[model samples]
Target: MAKTIFITGASRGFGKLWAAAFLEKGHKVVATARDLRSLDDLVNKYGTNILPLQLDVNDRAADFAAIAQAKQHFGSIDVLINNAGYGLFGSIEETTEQQAREQMETNFFGLLWLTQAVLPVMRAQGHGHIIQLSSVLGLVTVPILGLYNASKFAVEGLSESLAQEVKAFGINVTLVEPNQFATDWGSASAAVTTPMPEYDGARAWLQAAASEDKIGIPEATVPAILQLIDSENPPLRLLLGKQGHPWTRQVYEGRFAEWDAWQEIAAAAHGK
Candidate 1:
């Protein structure tokens, strides 16, 4: 059963691969990028099924226009994937306020605006899936990447709440958490200045830990994403790489365990 799909940031990275995978599966894909020229190869290959459109998710009017065009082109969008985001790495003190807000604007608010734009269309059709491209960083906070982590963390919270809100309307929300995957995201991460000369040693360690070269097979995520789209019951959170599984579980488990341990004390303090 081929369905119409609309994806942002389809010029490259996971968005590009996902667009290709859907096209290969005989689905109609409205692939969008900030520059339509970057998607020329995909346009040439898929021709009719792949409609490359110019879209900058941060632009509210432009994003709405893109969504309208997709609906008009494919009748209705069965799947909407919000993958237009970038990584901005820096410590809280080292990064400027403007830089921090910009990160949230692109990674968090941009996704929100797009989701809002597509919701009515999905609800009108009676069913649709919305996929949000998040990062393992969203689950855990690491050194130096505070800004990037904060942005993704916001998405994690947004998706969790949005999932419940739209569940009644037959709309599903999925969050994609990739370990490292060979993408240009690492190179695009914001460069932060080291305020303290003494922290030089720590900064180097953070850089190595966050390197993109350590991750493998960026294409692996696309299969899981597609599987969720096709499944009758898909998980709200989709962890991409095997390397991230244990760590991600541990983070949540550890936090829950600690919270449980403090429950009695918390209740007593609140006069419960």
Candidate 2:
């Protein structure tokens, strides 16, 4: 079935690809970017099927207004892809307070505001799907991506709670934890901090290990997203890419093992 899908950050990267794919599949796409002019290619290719709008996810009022315009234009939004976040690369100590806040504002709070705006429309219609673009770092920690990790971790928790809360309204939420893809995400969409000598070794090693040649195909994410949307019982969390699954499993299993090892100590604290 052709549905109205709204995607943020649709000027480039995964957002642009998703918009193109959905339009190709005969779906109405409301594609939004900070600069409307950047979406010229999408507009040209998809024509009337694509509604390109200017939206800065950091702006709370603009989020509501953009969503309102999208709903008005499309009549209803069946799927909302909150893909308007960027990566902030720096250790916790290296990242400034302002940087951290800005990261959360776009990646976490922005998603929350947009979701809030769309919920009423979906509630009234009694059906909708909200797809959150998270990262594998949301589940496991890395050296230089502390702020980005924290932001995605917040998305993970928020989406899980939202899924449980909105199930009664026939609204589904899915958190997509993707591994590195061959997109400009690491370059264009990332905010890098000034380097500090203290963390130079680890940071350098990580950077050297992250070769551009290793990035997976960006289109690989589309099939998983489409399957999730079509699913009658969509999972709350969907880890994309082969690397994400194994890495996530390892992290979770290690944590579980540690917890089990301390089970006696943990249980004793609960009772006399």
- Which candidate number would show the highest lDDT if scored against the true structure? 2
TM-score of every model versus the real structure: 0.93, 0.96
Model 2: per-residue Cα lDDT over 1-272, one tens digit each: 99999999898998988888898888999998988888898788889999999988888899999889999998999999999889988777889889999999999999999999999999999999999999998999888998898999999999999999999999999898888888888887889888789999879877886777756898887887777877878888887877888888898999999999999999999998
Question: Which residue pairs in candidate 2 have backbone atoms (N, alpha carbon, C) closer than 3 angstroms, thus clashing?
Answer: none
Q: Model 2: residues >4 Å from true position, as ranges?
A: 212-214
Tell me the deviation in Å of residue 262 in model 2: 1.1
| Alpha-carbon local distance difference test for all models | 0.85, 0.89
Candidate 2's displacement at residue 234, Å, is: 1.8
* Residue lDDT tens for model 1, 1-272: 89899999888888889899999999999988988998898888888998888877888888888899889888999999999888765556777878888888889888998899999999999999999999888998778778889889999999999999999889999998888777787775334544666666667888777566668687766677778889777789888887678887888999999999999998899974
